[model samples]
Target: MLINCVAYQEGKKLADIPIEDISEYLSHPKCFVWVALRDASPEELATMKEEFGLHELAVEDALRGKQRPKIEEYGDSLFAVIQTVEPHGDELTVGEVAVFVGANYVLSVRRDAQQGLVGVRARAEREPHLLSIGSAFVLYALMDAIVDRYFPIVDALEAELEIIEEKMFASGAGAQRDNIERLYELKRKGLVLRHAVMPLLDAMGRLYGGRVPVLVENCQEYFRDVHDHLARILGRLDSVRDTIGTAIQVNLSMVAIDDSEVNKRLAAYAAIFAVFTAFAGVWGMNFEYMPELKWHYGYHMAICSMVIVCGYMYYKFRKSGWL
Candidate 1:
């Protein structure tokens, strides 16, 4: 669907149009046109690209849905790409959102609109300020919404990590291995988001370098605010990654301690077994000259000696706190 927003000093409002009316709709000076397309055919995209006079590089970037997040200056406009993440089952589903921002209009296209762009587009229409605030505000507002979604995803990951951490303190190291896999997956998602956002920051800075047109300059602070928000979100992701690292280390450390305890106990038991085994082997020689074999109490005495030795060893272990 094509959405055109007219920005005024007080607020903004939007007008909806069919995709084919983009050319006619863009004729208005107040028109900040947004062409949000979903699953357009190659032919449709090619025609739109030519109509909008988009740079070949920008066109190529849009068609190549997996392109990294970036921003570039075309002749009179800036093209930016961002990745929006969706919660898909037990993991995140990522898709690209490509945008073209000019002095008068902004065009955004996504491979699929199910990732939440529809809600944002609807919001711009539902709210008066959004449609009237020019392309810059719209740009930042859209970015802000996407960034806001990341918070809940990250929070869920942190909560899961907390549970795993508690288990790390307990004796469930083997069972928590899957949690490490989940942590790694989250870190990978963060890495993907960083790749997409970092370039946009550079693009935004360069767009405002030295001087910007009055329209963009007026909204420069808004850009800066969104940049700050992106930075803070990235910082949270980094902290989550580090926390995951520490949790894994804690798990390993606990496993090592448990293994050491098991080895110490096994060593004590093995020593006791060795002493009794040797005593049995020597007495089993069955020489006719062995006098103790004739005494009935000899059997009891040997058993008693073995029990006493084991008891003494257990007492020593308890004293040393190795049991």
Candidate 2:
């Protein structure tokens, strides 16, 4: 799908191009275009490659669709690959965002159509005035929303970390184990997010660092805004990493405390049983002249003694907080 954003002044649109094939309109500096393509087939890639003079290496990366988050200098244009974040079940999935950017236009392609440029497409359709800003500004707006998705996901991880912190004490080994797994999951997500966003910061820096043609200056502020967003995101992810470390430590301490309490209870039970076993063992030595054998109440007295010893041990254990 194409979202055409034409340049404007005094509430007028001058020229327009397919939002997905914007590289074609770069010759006309008075107007700019942005094309957002998704799941482009091999034929589509061929057409795009021909139109943009895309390097074979870049096209190969785009077609194969597993490129790491990076920016490649292609002389007149720069090719970049970034990830689009989405949740798939309990874990998050990274969507590839490929772009072939030139002097006056930018072409963005996604690995799948499911998440292609719907948000940006909607914005352009809803507000025709955005076309007046130029290609760089439109690219910034699309990329900005893509970056913002990281914040909420990170916030969710933070909230989960807080909950796990509270339960880490009272929970059992099973719960602690689950929390550790969750920590690893959160770390993985953060890494994925980092892969998706961190490169764009450098890409933006390079773009606005006087590398691009004069047409992009109009959109420098927007790219800087994106960079600031990324910086804050990176900081937040770092904080979560620290919190995960603390959670693991607390969980370990709690497990140790739990084990100690259990051991103390077992020891108390063992002490109580030891008294009964000793009393039985001593009295069971069937000797002909045993003193207890001569007494009628010896059996009753021995029973009472055993009960007393058991009760006393129970009381001591309770007092010592070993129960």
Candidate 3:
């Protein structure tokens, strides 16, 4: 669906133009058209391809709608695919935005992404000097907006990691289990963010320094800023992943410790009972020649001996912290 199609010249808005008028606006000097689409159909994409003279391969990738985040050059024009990430309950929902940027036009096709780039256009209009730089500026603005959104998600991931860490050693039958599950969930979200950021980081890096795309060559600084933002996000993502790894290991260790404690108590009790059983078994074997069996106090004596030995063993186990 077409969200908006507007024309601009010399850093200012001219008017909202019909789709047919896009080519007409492009013919004028210092003018360009910016178009936004949401889940565009194949027919709409084909129309856009004709209007912008977009490369067929680029159009096909956009139509497919789940291309890996990347930047490709087709002569003087640039095509970019960036992933959009949003937090959905305990999981992260992934989306895509395909951007076709030329000297005089920008076509942004969004797929499966809930957030719109309206604010980016507004921000660009507010700063006419930057908008006047042409389609490159618009591309930067859109990327900046998308990259900025990742900050909040990083914050959320960090916040969740801290919460889990605080409860890492919490005492309960299910505490460690719950934390391990949550850490793995958190790790999965981090991986989603990593998959989104890493490719863009590599793609954006090419827009600045050394060899650069002609369309964005003049706006290298802006692209560099974007590259820096991606780098920051990547760093934080790595940290979050590492912390999650350590947290999971710690939770596992806690589980092991609890199991060991249980085994120690069971072994201690078994040892004490084994001693009592040994004494009872020996006395139960009646031998006619056994002198103690003839004494009237023999039964009491044997009972007393068993009680004394079991009591001593119980005391030793308790003092050693085994019981």
Most TM-score-accurate candidate: 3
Residue 123 Cα positional deviation in candidate 2, in Å, after optimal superposition: 4.3
- The sequence of per-residue lDDT tens digits that candidate 3 reaches over residues 102-198 is 9999999999999999999999999999899999999999999999999999999999899999999998648999999999989889999899999
lDDT of each: 0.69, 0.73, 0.93
Evaluated against the true structure, the overall lDDT of model 1 is: 0.69
For candidate 2, write residues 1-323 as lDDT tens digits: 33334433322455554435345455555544455567777787787677667788888888889777776777666677877888777878877788777655567778752455667655754555655665555566677777887788888878887887777766577777777777777778778787776777666686565655455566777777878988898888889888888878877777778788899999999999999999999999999999998999999999999999899989989999998
Off by over 4 Å in 3: none
The lowest-lDDT stretch of 10 consecutive residues in candidate 3 is 165-174
Tens-place lDDT digits, model 1, residues 20-124: 666775666666566666655667668677656778788877877887767666776877777777777776677877887776666677764366576776676
Error of 2 at 252 (Å): 2.9
